[model samples]
Target chain A: MRRERRRVERADDVGPYRLLRLERDGLDAGEPGQFFMLEAPGRLLPRPLSVCLATPAELAFLIDPVGPGTRPLAALAPGDAIHLLGPLGRGFRLDVERPLLVGGGIGIAPLPYLSARLGGPPALLGFRTAGHAEAAALLPGAEVVIDPVLVTDALPSGHDVLACGPEPMLRALTAIYPDAQLAWEAPMACGYGACYGCAVELDGRLQRLCIEGPVVAARRVTGASTMRAGR
Target chain B: MIPVLNASGCLDALTAPDVARTLDAYVTKTVTPLPREGNPPPRIAETDVGMLNSIGLANPGIDAFLGEHLPRLAGLGIPIWVSAGGFSAADYAHVCSLLDTRAEVDTIELNLSCPNVDAPEEDALAIVAAARAATVKPLYAKLSPALPNLPGTAAAVAAAGADGLTLVNTLRGLALDPATLRPRLAAGIGGLSGPALRPVALAAVYACARAVDLPIVGVGGVACGRDALELVAAGASAVAVGTALFADPGVPGRIRAELAVLRGRVPDPGV
Candidate 1:
């Protein structure tokens, strides 16, 4: 929960997304599906970015620059100071012997970390086009699906599913694989439990996504209308 | 010395107990009579200079908060200021009365200015009066910055037996998405807080400090020690850090330390 100023080692453009490698010292090896709140200078709120890669000296985040909050983060250059809070929120639970990773669009942010932890699991990734499919390379043995078809339709049967993506995609996947562990994203103010801004409806109650989960059991999610992705 | 506290709903004491322990008093999120799911998602938006949120007074309700969180919060060894909100005067009274019996509770903050709710300015005095009759504990009416006559409202609440005022809650604001041409927040509008609202809060504290003789808890947009000092110089007896907690959880302690440094450097008027 300490805020630290980390230097950006690199900000590389990968199709429609940007990958930022930050030089953070003494950071814990983040668990799969965990995220950090990145605050650029001059933005009122920080963007919640999942840890795409974590090492002792550096942390990587895959970002989609859709709104004012994230656009600046994507435009970072080397040696820029970016403020960060966390390695926060519960990550994906990897308990099954056979794990399948599924991600849609930038929702694939946490899969690479999960795959690395599982020693490279099979992944099914979805994107708007082949151009946006470059992220699939991060996941070993991943099959990419272009638009007009959802990645959920390609879910391999009989494997423990770990998924993250847009709300509609998550909803569709949860219906088919209710036992999956989902990394949910919502427009958050504080990427912690304080603001209760990133609340999701689960079991007929509202839960803060920042603490209760960025990763949660699909069955507990109940539905998708309560979820709103980054603006 | 008056202790610096966090305004209700701004900090989750349970999640960050270490940070909460640093504050002189811990203010819980506003609890209503019954459980609240709060507003829909897209409840928060970032404006150019501040943040907007329509959390809609979300809480586990009084019973759950008192039962589940109060014991743990009491263990933190900081004075607990339970913030109570409701739809009607009686609701405020009921919640306040229940908290009055708890030995762990040090003060009750009557949240009279939640923009997300249909809380009327006219009800401020009535709500305070009702809660005043129900509890012997000290009461602080958290005021709204949007009120037309803030001094008059502050005077009314004070006359109704409120011990002090938590000057200036968030001002209502809206942010529209440029791409979709839709409201950024699902709630359509939310209360604005952060550096943007600091001046408004200072103005309210200054006027109210002159209008009423009660202690004032300056809130809204306090980010640093300088901001807190400005509010105190404007006549606030204490200040609470809010939206800044998002950027840095250690802000409260940092501001406290900075304030001490600022105070030590001040030359005595006698000299």
Candidate 2:
């Protein structure tokens, strides 16, 4: 949970997103779904990003320039310096049989790392267009879907499901795979539990997503309103 | 010497004990009489200038905090200040009385103005007076910068027996969604905190410093050592880091070192 100034190694294009690779700088990449708070230059608040990939040398984030905060993050270049505090929050539980990875759009950020941890298990991804689906290349042999064909439409029974996506997709997946480990989203001021800004309705109570989970049992979440809490 | 503290409801000490350890004093989140679920989600919005939060004072209630959180916080080796919140004067007084006996509690910060909740009809002076009567512990009234007559309120609160003051809670703000053009926060309006708040905090601290002789703990958008110095220059005896701790947990130590560089001596908390 140390905040360090890390230099950007490179920024690679992955479909509509930017894969900003940062010098590892000895920072622990906690768990697959655990996130880092990246300080965007000139922005008042740092944006919370999930670990997209963590190699021995570098940690990478898939940035979706959805709003004001993320635009500068996606626009990073080689040699750029940024402050990052992480690997915060709870991530996917690794104990499972017949592991399956599920992601949608930018939610695919954690899959590459999670897959590596889970022995490169089967993955199903959904995106709005082929350009966006190009991120699936990060996962070597995952199944991809283009909406109006949702990733949920192709879920295979008997596999322990772990998923991340927009509210609609996560809710639908929760209905089918109640015990699935679903990664949730919320606008977070602090990646740690301090701010309580990342709270979302879970099990009929408002719980800080950054603390209780960025990852949780799907059945525990009742409403996913903070999904609109921005990127 | 400017002591550094954390704004109430901003840093949860138990979750980030290392971060809390850097502060001169660790202020707990506003403990209310009853447990709070807080407002619905979409509780935070980040604008170009700062961040807006409508967390609505959510907590496990004072009893739970005293039982579960206080002991651990006391063990952290930093001086503790409890931020007390409630709907009525009695609520404030009752909570204050409970902390009056806790040796771990070095101060009681009466949260008179949290923009996230419906403002109480009872004014800051009444709240201060009520809490003042209930507790032997030092009371520092945390006021809002948005108060129409801040200096006057500060004077009144001081006269009513407040030992000190925490100048400037977050100012009221609203952030609209760019595409939808609607309120971004579910609560519609929230308390704004960050660099954007430094000037407003300075003004409040400056004005309150002139109005009351008591020590003031300045808070709002204190991101760096320069900001803390500016607040001190504006008559604040201490500064509390709020939003910046979220972005950088190491901020307190950095600010302290920077302050030492600027002033040539480490500021004592004087707790």
lDDT string for model 1 (A15-86, tens) is 889999999688765688988888965687777888998777778899888877678888899988878988
Question: Per-residue lDDT of A1-231 in model 2, one digit per residue for the tens?
Answer: 468899999999998899999999788999999988999878877888899999989999999988877889999999999999988889999999889999989989999999999999999999999999999999989999998999878888998999988888998998899999999888888888998988888888888898989999998988745676455
Model 1: CAPRI class: medium
DockQ, every prediction = 0.71, 0.79
RMSD to the native, candidate 2? 2.0
lDDT by residue for model 2 (B1-271), tens: 5789999988999889888998899999999999998988788888878889999999999899889989999999999999999999999999998999899999999999999998877989999999999998999999998889999999999999999999889989999988899999999999899988999999999998888899999998998888998899888899999998888889899898898887765454233
State each model's TM-score restricted to chain B: 0.96, 0.96
Q: What TM value does the first chain of each candidate achieve?
A: 0.95, 0.97
Q: State the displacement of the C-alpha of residue A62, model 2, in Å, after optimal TM-score superposition.
A: 0.8
Checking candidate 1 for backbone clashes, the offending pairs are none
The total number of steric clashes, by the backbone 3 Å criterion, in model 1 comes to 0
